[model samples]
Target: MRIPIGRFTVPPEQPVVEEKTPSPSDKEAGVVSEQHPSDHESDNDAISSDAQAGVKKIEATTKVWSKSHLIAAYIGIWIIYFVDAMQQGTGTLLTPYVTSSFQEHSLTATTSVFSSLIGGISKLTLAKILDIWGRPQGYMITVLLMTVGLIMMAACQNVQTYAAAQVFYWVGYNGISYTLSVFIADTSSLKNRGFMLAFVSSPYIATVWITGPMAQSLLQGIGFRWGFGIFSIITPIMCLPLFFLFTYNYQKAKKQGLVVIEKSGRTFWQSVVHYFWEFDVICLILLSGGFALFLLPFSIYSYQAYGWRDPLTICLIIFGGLLLIGAFVWEAYFAPVQFLPWSLLRDRTVMGACCLAAILFVEYYIWNSYFTSWLQVVLNLNVTQTGYVSNIYSIGSCFFSFFVGIAIRWTGRFKWIAVYFGVPLTILSIGLLIHFRQPDTHLGYIIMCEIFYAFAGGALVICEQIAVMAAAAHQHVAVVLAMEGMFSSVGGAIGSSIAAGIWTGVFPVKLAEYLPAESQGDLASIYGDINVQLSYPIGSPTRTAIMDAYGEAQKWMLVGATAITGLAIICVVAWRDIKVKDFKQVKGLVA
Candidate 1:
């Protein structure tokens, strides 16, 4: 039987354009080609030049809607950013809610259910839809999904209902964001792509910074449902401007016959299969695995295990936003096609960079989630102190990641830098986590740890991003990026789940064993209560058990981070080196 591989294939060549010059008699057709010696392209170009030369076009004569249209575009982008930020920022919160709703659920069960429902199916389905439908249409469908899902979540009466709605909403929204990034890539020019993409990321930063206060205020004033209800209002409101931008772009492209996409006429399943067959497929798979491993544990740590002051969560989130924004800019402008490219995987220099980035991400999750909690819970610092100490990591990452891009450009040899600095730093940082696993660390010691890890990890991440894009062929860059994002998301989910499960399952069993016979009745009663309002406190056996469990969990994360980095090192080893030839030379070689 012949295999039916239905997938969109990358264009084999740029569209062949045939230039024609009109004869003098047919001058009305307007010769716009450079081959025509005349300065005038058309009566329209002449008129456009003449009108603008004499005077600044008066405001009254200019298009009135341009300003409105631009405003709408900005707002539309903000809305997308807002929802995206929340989906990520609120991930930790969601697991606990799911756990509570399903009383007998293990962390693995909850995470697996969530990953399959939200990450796996949602991403795959939405990706297909994005390919078939234009960005605007896909975005509209996403908005509809989120709106309906949020409404359902607000009204949810049980665990299964909530999970189903979350899956529906996440699939649409997540897919739309990925498609939007591709859309942004297409719309932007090379010179400004980096800055423009960074501009788009501003909302993620703003949301992280602002949502803490907003969530706290709402929770205090109205309660959980009302807080979510008020937040949900922002979703539909954000879509109004998107409606205008998407509609305008779609219509303009349609009129110009510029909206044509290469449709290979492959069946849907074939397309997915073809997607996986490409070398870019491995990047996606690995990155997703890394992300799931890291994020799953981190998400559950905040609420389920640590009960951190809310502001701390917010600050860490904002820091992540900043680092990601920097990464976005680096990916867009400096190394648009290199950072996560298939070509990069072929080059040892660039592969080292990509490996470094994955390792940095793992370090970021481990230090931010576990290390900070260790300082607060074990060291006994107040929330304010922990917040300040933790923010130090972000500060270090922000400064170094920005400069590292320029440094790579200055040095010209990224391979030497990555192998010498990045690989070692990653190994060392993981070592720090394992070595510094004391029961009660001092504040100054914690600050020193943050400064070292953040600076090294941050710089490595920036280099890796640049390396991936810088090494890839131009057309394959976007595919590489999409793969990177998929993995990052998956890693995060995995990290949070691992952390939560270790604490909840292992520690609880230990607690049952550790309690004295006389106090056992009291402990069992306390644990059994299960109500939000517990009458007992004072370092009860239950609380101690929870803390000890989490402390042990931290050790496991250190081991996992070290192991993952080891794999990254192997991937680096797999990478072969290629000389950096000019784009024209590279293109000729590929051809």
Candidate 2:
């Protein structure tokens, strides 16, 4: 006797007994056959053939709509990028003015802390929301949060309110960016994903140039309120098309039975409970609180009376560390549904890509935290000049990202690019930056360093994204990418905190050491006021001393950045050379 096993028919030893007979209802529902044994074998063969035909029909329908919907989705994505670039560029250029208005130079680091904390939490939250609820809902919530933040900032009368508003804005900004990346991953094959990401991001290059100058003019002319207010309106309008596109496609998918609506005959409260279980809300709270408590102390310690030795700081760090440990244990062994997929830990490529992203960001933000202020004080560049010089990085990022996208599309390889171009150029650029930190360094040299650093950094971004996506299973793409973003955000926060700590710890002391004894009393006043530091005449002893202190502090920061970039090279080297191919093919093999 022969028994069917998938496509093959296997011969069994001895006579095969007939299984239990189907009831009348089973026959009516087409679940089981009520026929002679020989007839039942033919019926089973026909059923299998019908199922295969149905699968092919569904695939044909999916291919047809996938192409059309993808084109519409890409158009919506481009519009979102245009609005996002304008908002980011304007906010970045206006940072100095915002901090100065609050009479705290260290507000730069403080704001970064706020952004990182909120951004990290938001990414973790939105990852679950996106994977569970779908992209359209996640996108709508992100835009709504950002709009509210912008409105609050525009209406803010105090520094407290402004800082509070930034929480919402950063969360929204990070969520929107992460959602867009997931969208690209969902629509494009691995072969073209890098190109698609770069193509969408290319708009930012042009937008940055315009918005940087525009932000300066807005701050100098109309004011910060109008700058924030105008974007609040533009963001929602630009994002509307995306909302419509996603909703339309989602409904269409449901109608086609491409998506099955999981229905549970549960009450509203039970539904909420189900969602909480699925999203692992407890783990999210523990993780977010733990990170905020531990990391935020570094940013604020310099302002405390006892600094790092403060009792409050000590308690925060201790409790935060404990909570983080608890969260890890829960996710690893106890949770029924784990948030962090521990299985990915065994995959060298995924972990390597994530670490590469995190380490590189840490390196970049070390010098980045104070580079603007360094230019103003040490190099004597005005706001407009500083904006132009600082924005050279964006110029480099824009062009290189576009070209790298094309390169990946053409060459079909990204690992060697990371090893040969991305890692080396970043190391070289940071080294040059350290060498050029002196007050007498030429403006051209600084600009060259910015260009080289940003261009190389752009290549790394493209490469890491491709590497991670290639290594992850298709269904897990969104969460895996979110994990990469989460690590990078945490790194940025840590880097900013470390940079602030070093600057605050060193700058005032260096200023005191460099200044004449008689003028040392003015140290507190100078730290409090940017204008006061700029008040001294050219080549004056006071101005020279301030510049010297800035140069020294920045040199240490760049040195730290250089070391981190070297570590990033090790991460790039350790990354597995996973070949980029269509995930559909990978899925086929697994199936």
Q: Give the best candidate by lDDT.
A: 2
lDDT of 1 by residue, 1-591 (tens): 111111222222222111111111111112111122232233221112211111111111111224344445545675677666654444333333344444522332344334432453244334333432334555677777776766666677666676666665665465556555545443332222323344454454444444444444443465445544654687777666766655664454334332223445667676566444422344334333433333433344434434334555445545545544554454445532223333324455444544444454544454344444444445554333544454555456555654554454355434454566656676776667666665544556656766776666555554454344444433333344444444544444444455454545454465467555655665444332222112224266544553454456677767777776766665555433322222210111010
Please list the residue runs of candidate 1 whose C-alpha ends up more than 4 Å from where it truly belongs after superposition.
Answer: 1-79, 90-109, 116-132, 159-162, 169-173, 187-209, 218-221, 239-243, 257-401, 404-423, 435-439, 443-475, 493-497, 513-519, 522-545, 572-591
State the TM-score for model 1. Answer: 0.60
Model 1: lDDT equals 0.45
lDDT of 2 at 199: 73
What is the per-residue lDDT of model 2 for residues 369-418, given as tens digits with 9 covering 90 to 100?
87777777888887667777777777677679878876876776788899
Candidate 2 has an lDDT of 0.71
- Candidate 2: where are CA atoms >4 Å away? 1-69, 260-262, 516-521, 581-591
